[model samples]
Target: MTTARIYQRPKNAMQSGRARTDNWVLEFAPSEAKKADPLTGWAGSGDTRDQVRIGFPTQEAAVAYAEREGLAFTLFPAPERKLKLQAYADNFR
Candidate 1:
C-alpha cells in the first residue's frame, strides 16, 4: 500500500506569486512491514525510504494524477504549526 500528501509551499518558499512549475509533488510511502526501497525515485532514506514522487502544475492536476495512478492522496496544510512554535519560543525568550 502507498500513501500520498499535497502541500502548498509557504510564500517564503515560493518564487514570486507564481507557484513553482514543479509545485505539486506526489510522494508514495510503502507499508512499514515491507522495509524496502520504493520503486520510484522519489523515495527517501531512513524512516521514509518507501516513498516516491511525481510533480504537477496545480493541486487539481496532482489530484487527477493521484486518482489516475490509483494511489491514496492527502493534502498538507501550510506549516502553521512551525510558525506557532516559533511564536511560543519567542515569548519564552
Candidate 2:
C-alpha cells in the first residue's frame, strides 16, 4: 500500500506578500528511491507521481482526495508560527 502525506501550506517569508498560505497540499511519497547521477551530481527518478502536488482550498478537500485515490494517508498537523507585528521604526530602536 502506498502512503500519502497531507499537510497545510507553510508560510514562506520570501513569498509573504504575494503568496497564498491558506491552502493544503497533498503529496505522494516516492515509492522508489532516487538514483544519483555521478557525472552531474544530481539525483532523480522517472516516477512522475513524485512531482505531483495537488493544492486544495481546505484540509478536508485534501483528505477527500487521498481517500478517493485509495492512498493510506498520514495527516500532518498544521504548524503554528507566531509572528510578531513590528514596524520598520522598531528595528531602529
Candidate 3:
C-alpha cells in the first residue's frame, strides 16, 4: 500500500495574510527508490506520480479524496497565523 501525506498550506513568513493557505495539498511518498547514474552521477527520481501535486479546497475534501482513492494517508493541521494590522501611514515611519 502506498502512503500519502495531507497537510494544509502554511502561511508565508513575510506576509501572514491568507496568501498561500487557501488550499490543502496532497503529496505522495516516493513509491520507488531514487538512484544516481553511474556515468554522470546525476540523480533521477522514479515515478512521475510522485511529482504530481493535487490541491483541495478544504482539508476535509483532501481527506475524502485520499480515502476514496484507497490511499493510506496522514493529515497535518496548518498553523494559525497572527496577522498584524498595519496602516499605510506606518510605512512612512
Q: Candidate 2: minimum summed lDDT over ten consecutive residues — where?
A: 11-20
TM of each candidate vs. truth: 0.48, 0.79, 0.74
Better of 1 and 2 by lDDT: 2
Ranking by TM-score: 2, 3, 1
Worst 10 residues of 1 by lDDT: 77-86
Tens-digit lDDT track for model 2 on 1-93? Answer: 988899887778776562657888889999889999889989998877899888998999998888998999999988887889999999888
Residue 64 in model 1: lDDT: 90
Error of 2 at 49 (Å): 0.9
Model 1, residue 17: distance off in Å is 9.8
**Candidate 1, residue 62: CA error in Å?**
0.4
lDDT of 1 by residue, 1-93 (tens): 456787665555445553453376777665555334567646344656344566776888888987887878787654453333456568777
Q: Considering lDDT, which of the candidate structures 1 and 3 is the better prediction for this target? A: 3
Candidate 1 Cα errors over 4 Å, as ranges = 11-22, 33-51, 78-93
The superposed Cα distance between candidate 3 and the true structure at residue 58, in angstroms, equals: 0.2
